[model samples]
Target chain A: MKISFPYMGTSHIVVSYLFEKLGFEVIYPPTPSKRTLSLGVQYAPEFACLPFKIVLGTYLEVVEKGAEILITSGGCGPCRAGYYGELHKRILHDLGYPVEMIVIEPPLVEPLDFLRKLHKIVKPKGIFNLLHYGRIALEKLKALDVVESTLHELRPLALDKQQINQAYIEGLELIRQADSVKEVIEAKKAALEMLESVPADHTFKPLRIGLIGEIYVVLEPAANHDIERLLGERGAYVHRSIFLANWTRDNVLAHGEKDIRAMAIPYLNQMVGGHGQNSVGEVVRYAEEGFDGVIQLAPFTCIPEIVAKSIMPAVSRDKNIPVMTLFLDEQTGQAGIETRIEAFLDLLWQKRKKQEAS
Target chain B: MQAYLGVDVGSVSTNLVVIDDDGNVLVDLYLRTQGQPIQAVQEGMKQVEEAIKGKKIEICGVGTTGSARTLSGVIVGADTVKNEITAHAVAASHLVPDVQTVLEIGGQDSKIIILRDGIVVDFAMNTVCAAGTGSFLDHQAARLNIPIEDFGGLALQSEASVRIAGRCSVFAESDMIHKQQMGHPTPDIIAGLCDALVRNYLNNVGKGKEILAPVVFQGGVAANVGIRAAFEKALGLKIIVPDYFKVMGAIGAALLAKATVKEKGETNFRGFVVSDLEYQASSFECQGCPNLCEIVNISVDDKVLARWGGRCGKWDTLSKTG
Candidate 1:
């Protein structure tokens, strides 16, 4: 089968490797762009969140490339994301694409059924064989996370940000081409060395800005207008709360929920659905870490993020940290976003100056 | 006299201010942008030249602000380019000295900036909504056949109060027409509109923001006394309107330029001759990648001065650093 998946940052690197190893021809969708967004908007419902539209556009592009199977994840929450798989299937069927969709629901919800579906899809020698490959794939994911986090840290400090960005892209490609666990580690080491080769100013301490919000918008550069790079270029150390590896560790392996839930209890007592509690908890954590500011990015009309945004003011006031929420949509312009970012950096710089003086 | 120049090319108005070394305004000019920022800026420059005619003033530094800051910065060879929010806050604090809040309603946007001890603490701008902005009021004034200049005075003449929805501009217009058909006087309706706009501003942009005392109201909309009265009534605090309310952004830019020149000991100003220079602005779609970005180019005598509006930074970086 020619298999495909929607792009979410570099998650595709591991996913394509896994599928290709499973004896399927992987057909990668083109990078999401203005054409993809416009196509998705033309076919999608008026109020669908940005990620949904973009994912739909990705699937459409893959279908044009003769992709036969589409893989997507599913969730059970109050947020509309839970119904994405079903809605995508219906929309695709209505549009006459007729591609097969496999939704991997959370195993904690229905382990037996999930294993049974996995068995049929894997069709391998045994479950142990699948586990071995899965472990290798996860190692690659970890390596990618490290490379990206390192890039975020070094980008602002480097004399040539373009050189840092180039190294990061080359690093991603190197990891994607590696086959074994040892190769992944070697690629990671090589990538870090590449970043280290860039000339940097180590004496300067840049403003610390934490990113907290919806996972798709936070991870996808195309959706958020390359906000991580924009902040880094503006001389701020960018720290994001969500990455594919950490997301998998929390949502799949089911580890590290206790700490976040405990932090969120003071403000958001319960989960309001997709990543709402995570956002609140991340803000509190960033505040405790003494970061200069937090920026919450969410798609327009996203319910979970909207709920999180409503409760952010109290947290910001109580923590004595400034928080800004930017609701992005197709109508968002680069000029407007850049202006807001410039103003926000000025605010942070002023706060830092006041702190130093007192 | 050594002076600094600040240009704010906004959506509706292009304002320019020339300030002396001591921050005293030497000359100011405001011209309607009218969907042509280049011509508006050139016209404003010409008028400023005429306004300061025979004065021994040399522009020591230049700055630009507002939505079209980048374009204007390139045209005027600005030493500093800043966003409108910072520019407004700087100007407000400079003028009022103790301004704790700034309520700025401009052509297509509204913002509330909170400051404490001469530093910005918090701020919020209206998102994806043009309901309570100056352009909406301008449109309504034209529809009602009342000149925009007399809008505030006519509203102040109302003897009775009415309510109109201000959640969306389209809904607000239909509601106004309904009230007009229901026999409510024009003054009453206008007063109701002023209240509605104020209400929208407070509920939307001012949400979750602490509006302290010593609030300064400025922007093009500050001239609307009806909106000012509505703000005073809503917040239950007296609002201070600065003498250079409409040109506050420009003043702030000039102040920043003055500061920059003092630190750098020189300026990048291209002089007043740039006002008469012929420049051509054009755009083309880039086919370099899947994102068919519409790249814009501004040229003088077919030599590209700047290019922007691309998703990839190839053109943008080339324009800025190359």
Candidate 2:
């Protein structure tokens, strides 16, 4: 069977491996490009969120390459993400593209919904066989997360762009070749070693930039146009707020630990929920920790980030930091981003120099 | 007595609110933003100064928020500049101590904020789509030759609800036309439009997540009783409309400034005479690269107040105070 998936940062890498292990041809959407966004905007409803536009673009591209089955995450909240699958399916069907969509809803509230969706896509031989593949997928996902986390730290420290990218390519290759959970762990270790061995020139004072914004845009290199690589190559250490570990920690585990009494605190005190809370906490933390500057990234029209943008000035003043808000749309060009980054870095450098002189 | 100044410069409106030390609002002014934020702030500040002229209101601190917060902050010498979310959340919390959800629909944007235990847990905003936003409703009201203020009352008088496709402004207009051609009453069609708007909001902007009670609907749209009624019927819960609904963002910003000023032991608010300063904005496409980002520079009496919009932070960085 031929299976397809949208580009969802590092998650796609693991999902592809799982499908490949099950003897299916897995077609991952090409890395996001201007063309991808244009295609998405062309096919998608003009008013739909940017993420939806990107996803639609990915599916259209993959379907053209002969992928029959599509898989995507499902949501159950005010976030339009939950309904994207249904909407996308309707849109595609209306456009004369017939295919099956398998949505994996969150396991917390809708385990049976996920199982039903999963069963429709992959009819495992039996319970044991299904459990076996699930175990493999879980292990691969964990390994991928570990490697990605380590790389997030290492990418900022690499001497040049080539070295960091080489390490990522090797790491992904190692992950793809691993056959067992033990092998996955070994691959992660090997990837870490490769990254650690890159020569480092610790001469220039690295500009520390805290990246805060939407999860998908922050983690996805394709979405942000390899912003970390561009910044890292220019002697800056990128402190990204979104990561698999952080997402799991904040969203999954922190739910029960929240002080329910805080519900009484009115607006600012209340959780005006979504990624805004996490972003506020992260930006505040980054400022407190003395990051040279902060970059707020968000898809154009993203509400939570808009809130974050409003609050960042207070964050900037409290911590004496500078924050630049970048709204990413399909029209975000590389040269535009590079110029902005260079100027931001220069500002940070000047600010640091001023501090040192004083 | 010490007072703080708060300015919120949004795409649609610019608001100025003055609050005393105990968080009591003393002076407030709301003006259309009208394409120029610096001018709006200057004008708004003039009104505020006039309103508090006789009182012993010393401008102890200034805070700015909304889309143009940074520029407004620089122009006014604001001690604190925050986003609309933080300012709104803070102000809303102060007003309604137990606000769990905040549904803010303004002229150009709509936001759904989920609050848990007083911290913003999850929030969604709508900037791309116009269906659920106030501007969309304003357009519809204009097309129907009805004053926007009376739109809600007319909708309430709707006996039969007609379903208008509220997917986008284009679709909504066509659907409304179709409903009108079907001989539907104006009130019923208006109510249906409101219902369609609420449905679109719930389906698109207010998608997945928990929407608890004690929901406060603010911003300019909160004044629309029909939309509020639609929300109540759709969600089956009572929605609270704060007293200063239209200017909540500005109020929240003032409250934040108060807190910041108290902590810092001083205020950096420029005097109200700043309203007369000549302000201008000019843009230039940077020849630095192919990106061709049109950098916007704001100046007052030839002194650069702020520079922004170039993608690479070139201009913004120059405006930064180290």
Candidate 3:
């Protein structure tokens, strides 16, 4: 069976591996680009969030390439994302594409149903082999996260940013090519070593900026217009609140502690759906950690993020941290975003200067 | 005889200013951009030279700011390339030393900058919306067949203010037409528009921002007395519009260039003769990737000067080295 999935940052690397292990021809969609976005935008319901349109575009692309099965995560929140699976399926059906769509809801939401769905897909191979392959995929994910985090930390300090970019690409390639847990571990070590060895001005002090927002735009560079790279290039240390591995461990494995969510209780006591509460919680955490500034990124017209954005100014005032929110969508111009970011950085720099003088 | 030149190439107009070492304005010129920024900039340079005919001013530094800052920087060899917000804030502070808030309405965008102790503390710009900008007012003026220069004077004659929707330009236009069809006076309609635009600016771009005094309002739209009065009536604070209101961005760029040159002890001024050079801007879609980024290349005398607009830095890097 040929299977396909949309790109969600580096998640595709590990996802394609798992599908190959499950004995399926995995044909993942290409990185979200202008062509894919237009295709998706052409047929998507007006006002759908950016991620939906991009993913829909990817599905259409893969369908054109003869992919028969499509696998996507199902959302379980009040946000519109929860209905995207059904909407996309309907749209594709209306477009006359005879493709089977598999929606994977969180296991905690429906444990028996989840296993039943899994049983239908996976061969009756022993559980041990499945576990082994899952372990390797998880390790690869962890390695990719480490490499990305390292790049974020070291990029601002590097004299030759090109070297850091090259190392990051090489690290991703190494992680993608590794077939076993041992090889993944070795690849991770090598990648880290290569990243750390890049020439850097260690004495430089970079302004630390925390990024918090909706999951899709936060993780996907294509969606957010490579904001992480832009911030890093401009001598700011970027600390993102989300990672694929951390999200999986928290959502799927349910292993992470609840302390982070607790941070939002003072401002947003209940679940407002999606990552709205998490964004507020992360901003509080970033403020407490003495970060220079915080930026919230989300797709335009996003409901949960609008909720978060409404309360951000109060959080910013109370915490005494500067916060800026950027809404990403089709109409987002790179120049406008860049100008705002530059002005935000200027504000941070001037604030720091005033503090030092005092 | 040393002076710094600043160019602000915006969507609607191009402004040029020359300031002496002590930051005294020597010359200021504002011209319509009219969709051709390159020609507008070159024409601005020629005019600046003509205006300072006998003044033996040496171009010690150059700066560029606005939407076309990067392109203007390449043409003039600017010592500083800064964004419009910072330039506006800097210029406001330079003129009104104790300015706490700045409300700037330009052609395509409007922004509010909150400053404390001469440092930018908070700011916000309208996102993908041009509802309450200079272009909005200009379009209405043109549609009403009233000369744009007479828009403010006519608006000032209103006895009763009509309420016009200003949520979006489209809605505002339709609402204005509806009001006109209802036999409302032109001055009242114009006055209503000014009020609606001010309300929209304060509610949207100026949302959640503390608009403290001494407030400075400067931009192309500041020339409109109607909008200025609307702002004053809304906030109940007297607005300060600098003498060089329309060219504040260029003045700010000049001020920044002065500071940059003071620090670096040198300048990147390519000289006034660059105005004589033939400049061309051309763009093509890149075929190497599915992104199909439209790459823009600016050249002078058939030699490529710079390339940009590509998501990947391949063409950008190639332009620099080649």
DockQ of candidates 1 onward, in order? 0.70, 0.03, 0.66
Where does candidate 2 stray beyond 4 Å?
A1-222, A225-358, B317-322
**Evaluated on chain B only, what are the TM-scores of all the candidate structures, in order?**
0.97, 0.95, 0.98
Residue range B1-322, candidate 2, lDDT tens digits: 8888889988788999998888888887889998878788888888887898888889889999887777898789999877677678778888888889889888777777666666654455653355678888888899999999999999999888998888887888998999899899999999999999889888766765468989999998899999999999999999999888989998998998888888999888778768888877878888765445677777777777777665444556654532
Model 1 Cα lDDT, one tens digit per residue, A215-302: 8899998899889998998899999998889788776554356687689899999989888988999999999999999999999899
Interface RMSD of each: 1.2, 11.6, 1.3
lDDT of 3: 0.89
- Cα deviation of B272, candidate 3, in Å: 0.4
Q: For candidate 1, what is the total of clashing residue pairs?
A: 0
- lDDT by residue for model 1 (B247-272), tens: 99999999999999899999998877
lDDT of 2 by residue, A1-358 (tens): 6889888777776678767666678887777655677788998887666788988988888888888888876542455666889999888888778878887755555667756765765563445555676576667677777776666566656665566677777887887788777887888889878877887654656788888777777877666767887777677778777655445443432333143223222223544434555566666668768888888787877776666666665656556677776667775635446545654665577577767977
* Candidate 3 lDDT tens digits, B1-322: 9998999999999999999988789999999999999889999999999988898898899999999999999999999999999999999999899999999999999999999899998998888578989998888898989888999888899999899999899999999999999999999999999999999999888878889999999999999999999999999999999999999999999999999999999998898888999998989988887667788888887789888887656787754545
